[model samples]
Target: MPTKSTRVPTHASTPVKRRPGGRSARVQDAVYSAVGKLMATQRPDQITVPMVAELADVNPTSVYRRWGDIDALLEEVAVAAFTREDEVLPDTGSLEGDLREWARVITDDIVRPHRTRYLRAMVNARDGVVLDACPCWTARREQLAEMISRAHTRGERTPSVEQVLDHVIAPLYHHVVFALPADTAYAERLVDDVLSMRSAESR
Candidate 1:
């Protein structure tokens, strides 16, 4: 938690260190907030750097210095926003239910103009830094592993985490990114297909 004075205060005074939980963190929070606020009513193309700077009460140079360009900022902010939503993996007592829910949410996000814009930007990030910066990537894989572990405990045949990702989750991501149709039914079927397959060539 941040103190009242440090909770997104203007940086016209002394500069804050860009470390986690510092003034720099507050600035990031404010900027993300400003982006969210603007995104609710406007399309991604309509959002400008100066507009975000104004909404965030920070300098345009600051925004430019940290994120490079509007599209870059959108990518970072969008990843952060979506990452927060999946912090708690779904557990509807069955893996199929959980997979379906996750797929629906992702599919819906992909169709949203604003969310998709940032996702596309991230997909084009050749440096591969954005995915590493996002906690969601690792956490999501872990959640899937946990789900498999639970099924194994129930005497059900289970695949490894990598198998699940490769056969199930990765396909859904491919569909969404490539603009293919992947609805809830498709999501459930993919999960079922993967889960039913034999692992380690034992079949």
Candidate 2:
């Protein structure tokens, strides 16, 4: 994981250029939806570009052209599915409340059966290649940065974004990936732990 001082890279592998809106948006949505449906019944290895193309009612060439291969497609789909880009950030008048709500929302989302499968599939698709940047991770980091900034503006002492990611967000996903319990209590504990780090620093 990159530290607070280190800049994160902007792309995973090669940057995939996607055309936004109109037919392009529709096709992308269809393909993403197809991948989700397939993941419900089949493992990541069992799914193929052709299967997705057929299910999505789009040409295989379209999938190939836009996403390259099945693994790439799966990665893109997982990134899209995992990040809540459209939602508003949690602002509960304090950094603690924001972190707890954010963690709770994440825990609730990733603990679902389908989401767990998607996460596993995304990991498997990586095939051991360490990415300097992942869209999903970047999105979460950006959200955290915003939340942290808000807290700063409100005169609340808070942990660095990296600290939050390391102590809270990372552990939540770690538990999910490892099939460990990542319940509401676990998320709340993580929030408390990270907040405690700030208190410890102040002391």
Candidate 3:
């Protein structure tokens, strides 16, 4: 039997801090846009801080002061691009429905060409950082926790967070990172497999 994967960290260990508005926000937005545009035409490995600063029309020092390094900037940009901060979590009245809808949304988003590029860029930017340290992974884990909490309140049988991460989330990301097929059906199947664990536990 496969041992359960460790729980993903609920939050980033070192969150990026920035002033909300005024000149600082503008500069950050420009830098993020510059990175997005560059990633469209250039590999993340080839892009440099100077290149980003030049494209954003900001001084190289500003980029460095804000993000410190090209890899850090890329990771931040990728995280910002991937997360929908304003979007509400699915509340479909059941864990199965919620997971299916959530999985479908994730499958649709990550499988897009631009998102695929960002996912690849995020992976390259990490070097060898554990998944627990990744802001993107932490965000997804938090979302999953919220959904699972709702299920628990409703007295629904639910799989542990580790089981969901291992059976559902991990497989989807594996397919994506490996350039294999990861469609809505595949995502839903993973959800089904994880939910089966809940059934097994009850039996």
Candidate of highest lDDT: 2
Instruction: Rank candidates by lDDT, best first.
Output: 2, 3, 1
| Deviation (Å) of 12 in candidate 3 | 20
Scored by lDDT, model 2 comes in at: 0.78
lDDT of 1 by residue, 1-203 (tens): 11112212221234333335767686787887788778767767778999999999999999999889887787666555444422356677776667667656656656665555555545664354534333335546767778767766776667676776777667766776677777777777777887677874354
- Per-residue CA lDDT of candidate 3, range 94-202, in tens? 9999999999988887887666777888888777577644566666788888999999999999987768877887888788878999999999999988887744345
Q: Write the residue-wise lDDT of candidate 2 on 78-141 in tens digits.
A: 7766554345689999989988998888899899887888888888888869877666777788
Candidate 1 local accuracy as lDDT?
0.65
Candidate structures ordered by TM-score, highest first: 2, 3, 1
Cα-based TM-score, every candidate? 0.68, 0.84, 0.83
Which has the higher lDDT value, candidate number 1 or candidate number 2? Answer: 2
| C-alpha local distance difference test of each model | 0.65, 0.78, 0.76
> lDDT score, residue 88, model 3?
66
- Which regions of candidate 2 fall more than 4 Å away from where they truly are? 1-19, 198-203
lDDT of 3 at 76: 76
Q: For model 3, what is the alpha-carbon lDDT of residue 117?
A: 78
